[model samples]
Target: MWRDPGAPADSFYEVRPECTDVPKSRFRIKAGKTLSARKWHAAFSPEGYLDIGKTLSRIHRGGIHPSIRGEVWEFLLGCYDPKSTFEEREEIRQQRRLKYAALKEECRHLFPLVGSGKFITAPVITEDGIPILDPLVLLETNTDNGVVVPPQDNNAGSTMAPSSTGANLEKVTDKRTIQWMLTLHQIGLDVNRTDRTLVFYEKKENLSKLWDILAVYARIDTDVGYGQGGSLTE
Candidate 1:
């Protein structure tokens, strides 16, 4: 069911110090019970069938525990079917992760800001898809004293030859890659404001993850590409 745009959210997930002054009642789940991680895992049998009917009923009534929100969302978002076996689900997740890694590599090649543990807020690519090489342009990095450790590009290496990582990017003339570059700035812009005050996004890596995820999405979903509200939805 769609929530009315004018109606209040069922619950507030983020709680900054500024938000602590609000009454707790305002944040309570509708049914007084959120689905716990233990119960969620328990719903899957040893053979790996998820009791989706019960799960949906619980979520409809109370939402999910914050601790398992992302995990539960994988199901709600159709990452896997309720009847999928554990082995099948694991296979799907592994394949999806490999695909994500490969896509990130492609984005990294187009704009090194990706996988550099830093995020961009200013426009980096022009309308013509030419990238600005300002080394100091990155806003912030998720690092230990700013030591960035890029995500491994070898996750998909076993399935395919390693991607050409340090090729002369100046010769990049692929239409799809160029189109993807054109949207990087907007993705970065939206990422900068998305969850900026939330504790989860306090770490810059999460911000980078958000940018790369959307960048890759924009690259693949050419019809819809990137939009202003994509980050908010993410």
Candidate 2:
């Protein structure tokens, strides 16, 4: 696996940066508390302006400053909701994993990436004065892993693993486990939210793909039938 600084590391918290001299009245720290239009503009000289594409080009070529990478990601995701504080953002984050198992199974193609510690997003700051960023940090972490932990809600004492019939690597269709599958699926979608809706794919199209994957898995691995609206409900 590629060594990346962004891989999972020891869990600890650090204090975020303080607001500079930007006018507190007009420019407020928003969700993620890492970015604001006023704050961003302030990062440059008062006379300078930023073009998003050009700025990204610079960062991509020159690399993002280590201190500001989190802010840059937040800005790119438009995750800085003005109404949500860091604590609120965290609560929302916790609620995102109510359906993890289903999501992992839904996007099962990416499973190998997770098990290989390839999806990690933390930097492994080097001992050298100049540090490099790496994304492979753990065998189990990914972009969604930060906000969503494994499902904790107990439902009827059933374990999460698919049944033997459904365990086939090529397919998963255990009917008795539809409830568990659907629950995990919902959690997956919730944790992947962005301020820009459907940023990566068309909303309807993505949902359709999810439906096809889950429906097929269910039919082949379980006795479950796809009742009307069942796919959407998932």
Candidate 3:
């Protein structure tokens, strides 16, 4: 992580240099006011029905505490319905995890960097959906990872991965998959630049996590694919 002398660490919670000129008493010194973990838990019923209105009031009042921020964001993002019961939300999470894993499994062979602790900002496929294997061209400014296009038959250039039959990898002829491949380099680019101001992105694994996220999104929403500056979806 990079040093920010004005603050302890460069992170979402850390105040940037530009924000340092504000009144500390109204901002920096008011950290204790954020919603605490205990209060956050109390907003949920035993059966897991969330007090959406009350929770929103508290959140908008002081923001959420970092300890439970991830869980809170899940609700905010509509990952689970506010009216859903505990058992229902648990089942939703399990199904979502399985679907995501399946999506990643489908994409892993299309590009080597899918789950690899590295990403590439270079073009790995052409407009016509052809694989590009030039190492020099695939290398990014501060990253390293090779592209892996699934194997295809000598006669037919199909991109099917035998998801149902469980056979060897095959070339992808599907337009959706090809579109997903085209967005890989862009995902790497935005991912690398996502939190560059903060030191958290210095770790390749962290960048890879972002890469996997965007890649999975691209795979899921092939119609929209991926776009530049899309990593700000917090």
Candidate 4:
């Protein structure tokens, strides 16, 4: 014959953190006092059925005895391998690869991020330390020292002769090319140890020395000429 311990009183069960998802039964002894027989009857009917929420309330209120720590950890970790499907893992891997591909595509534009330009300096440093002339024109005559000419100032005289204007324009163009070459060289040097190509070197020293030898070849081979600010893309 079943007997009631008395009126229903609030109770709790002991739940380990490892098995937070599955709580222990409320009928277990708790706090030196077992759950009242009537309370257990309402919590669990005959035929061994259990009410999870009612058990959860008992567990929350510390009404049940605690389980072994190791067993709780094993259950929480899913050591039982309930999801025995490899499909989920494969899907996760595919998603990760897709994410990586997207990132690579986004950053693909930055090619020569740290390498210098490929052209060597075309210079004949005068004993006084000034470049004599444009390096490309003098390549055939002498590779050791390029012609030295003072860079002309267009601002010195606004209404200069045609010859002067032509010279000025040539000088401006040379200066621009040289400046670009130097910038590439510096960036290439910075990324040297990283195994990136600074600039392609000629197999045999060409008589025609200029900054854009490899650059020209790259343009021809790849069919992509230099674009403004594209150097930074490197």
Maximum-TM-score candidate: 3
- lDDT by residue for model 3 (193-229), tens: 7745445556778888888888888888867778888
Per-prediction TM-score: 0.70, 0.23, 0.73, 0.17
Q: 23-130, model 2: which lDDT tens digit per residue?
A: 222222223232334444445433333345544555554444434556666546765443345566666556654444445444342222222212222321222211
Q: Kindly report the root-mean-square deviation of model 3 from the true structure over all alpha carbons.
A: 7.6
- Which of the predicted structures, 2 or 3, would earn the higher lDDT when compared with the native? 3
Residue 62 displacement in candidate 4 (angstroms): 64
Off by over 4 Å in 3: 1-33, 138-147, 150-173
Evaluated at residue 17, the lDDT of candidate 3 is 49
Q: Number of the top candidate by lDDT? A: 3
Q: What TM-score, to 2 decimals, does candidate 1 have?
A: 0.70
RMSD (CA, angstroms), candidate 2: 20.2
lDDT of 4 by residue, 124-197 (tens): 22333233345452342132222223235534211111121113332223333243333433322332322122
Between candidates 1 and 3, the one scoring higher on TM-score is 3
Candidate 3 lDDT? 0.66
